[model samples]
Target: MEHSPVRKLLTEAGQRQVEARIKAAEAGTSGEIVVMVVEESSRYRHASVVGALFSSMIVAVAVGHFQGGDGMWHFLGVFVPLFIVFHELLVRFAPLRRLFARKGDMADAVGKASLAAFYAKGINGTEAATGVLIYISLFEHMVRVVADKGINEKVDPDAWPELVGGIVQGIRSGEAAAALSEAIDRCGELLSRHFPIREGDRNELSNQIRY
Candidate 1:
């Protein structure tokens, strides 16, 4: 686990708390819930390149003004090194990269990452198709909740937005663990209503928060 990035969202104690919540939630239903946290869903390299070039151009313009020339050599002298430096900075610093990335692109990245995580973590492999994944990308400040087909066919589709909204708000308010606990409880309630615990229900996935 990358401790620094997720420390705010889940501390050591909070991780245990969330795991306990998952256990409690699963006791009432056959559904499996997995919460996955990532520093970033995607690198957004294009955003970094664009940001670097744009910033380098502004500095190069100032250099050209003082150097009294629109000469190619003059521009390249300042622009090339600066562009390299800025690009490296953007790559190393997620907040800078995010500053230049488009909202739609970030959303798409998170959506895809969440789906990938849903499968990667084995949530999709549950016997009853009663798995749910809650994915959080800290750099993007985005949350995605993915439910298996079994739950989707029975639960109201409209309810997802509110579920997602609460987590987003919790993230903004620095209460992600609490909100996620509640979300798990809600998922449990919904699952219990549709797929109550069976005679030989077994845990099909890990309860730990994936990092």
Candidate 2:
């Protein structure tokens, strides 16, 4: 059987969604509310790694000084900050967000939103209309994928709780793409099961499209 391009596009779209989420989580947001959220998330991860390294290096240095040894202290002095600098570089250059979104203010929101919309389309199984899909894709690039902390307050108030809840759950669980893929499959199954287009309906749709 010939492979369907739709399936490939949808799979790529799903992978992009997961990667975008990981990038947003790592890069964080801006503005007053967003800044706080970003700071908290970054600190949470940084504290563990930075704090442990700092403590260990300090202990080693102190012990070396007490024992009148220069080797361990000298080595740690160079190693500690080098590690910190490298960690900062990774955080700054995380490939996920960098590849999709431009490195600027507008780019951050637009990039995240675009990815989310693609994810939503994949979930809804309505990605076939080239024009409509492209139009919706514009909005996808505009929406901000704010950090997961306190998302309820950050997102639009009118959005369905279930929708927001699902995204939030995916972010927290670190399985947004898997969850979304499963959701899309479930949606497809439901559509096929309950609203399948019969031969007559397919003919009608084809006619409508032609006209």
Candidate 3:
């Protein structure tokens, strides 16, 4: 779990707080809330590599042109190794690497990844379909709430955007765990109202923070 993208930014105490919130949130509801945080949904290396090479080519051309033939050779000589290093560095660096991807593309990536997680984590398999997934993809800076059909049909569709907004703000403020817990609480209230825990209601999914 520690090696998972979800664990990259959270502290041990923060992780525990998130777990506690999940437990508390489920107390009155049969709905299952699963939190999945990730460093990135995709490597997006293709975009990053293209961006790096394009920028390097421009720089090399511009610098070489200004310096004359000798300068061009020198610039190319220097840039080859520098570009290699830059490419590697850019691939790992979020702010720079992200430039390679469009905002819409990132959003799309996040949506696809979240949907995959919804099924992979067994949120789709919950009894009564009362499962909700809070998915955070760090590189794209996106947060999505995925609810199963039961909750979706019972709750208002407009209700979640505001709730998700709160969590997004919290995460932007570097309050990863707090933001997740808050979102869980908000979702829990909705679930409790619509799907109050019945006798013999069981936890269909594990409460541990997923990466």
Candidate 4:
């Protein structure tokens, strides 16, 4: 239930557009490109505890000020209920929960999730080792570009940051689909340059966007 944050990040039309973009991107290159989106990279349950604790402390301080007492008992009482309430709130609301999560933790989680997605979706299964994964973690507002060994050998890893930044900017502007379309086109250019489609190249991956 915690994972089910309103799957409204992309509409049906947006998904189709992204899927089409993936197809077009792969057409010019032997590389297989896959786009995967997730509501979140991780549950980040610790964030809920941290949020609850912070909220409870604030409320307890106010309560103590009003009651004019040592406030240990008052603090405890307020903390117990507030912790429960805030914990649920943070878990259900990603924007609020994000405030409590460390940037390092979010980055690590997204990095690992993208790698998992690359393997899970069989993006690594291409014959020429030219598969590339464009992974998006919505809750963390992160984008990771994972390229297979074949492509990595020819293309510098540094080439991906600009592409990732474009997607991140798009996410911030609420135009993720369009941003991704442009990024995929750029990816196609890069891939085709390094790994142009061979006469016998076959489509090794599905063009559909993965959830």
Give each model's whole-structure lDDT: 0.88, 0.34, 0.85, 0.87
Screening candidate 4 with a backbone cut-off below 3 angstroms (N, C-alpha, C), the clashing residue pairs are none
Root-mean-square deviation (CA) per prediction? 1.4, 15.0, 2.4, 2.5
User: Which ten contiguous residues of candidate 2 have the minimum total lDDT?
Assistant: 202-211
Q: Model 2, 65-121: lDDT tens per residue?
A: 776776755767755765566456444543322333323533444445444543443
lDDT computed for candidate 1: 0.88
- In terms of lDDT, the poorest run of 10 residues in model 1 is 1-10
Query: What TM-score number comes out for model 4?
Result: 0.92
Instruction: Write the candidate numbers in order of decreasing lDDT.
Output: 1, 4, 3, 2
In candidate 1 the C-alpha lDDT for residue 52 amounts to 99
TM-score of model number 2:
0.26
Taking the tens digit of each residue's C-alpha lDDT, what string does model 4 give over 1-211?
2233224556678778888988888889999988877889999999889888998889878887888757468678877888888899999999999999999999999999999988888888899899999988888888899999999999989989999999999878988789989999999999999999899889998887777
Name the lDDT value of residue 127 in candidate 1: 91
Per-candidate TM-score against the hidden true structure: 0.95, 0.26, 0.89, 0.92
Candidate with maximal TM-score: 1
Best model number under lDDT: 1
Q: Which residue pairs come into collision in candidate 1?
A: none
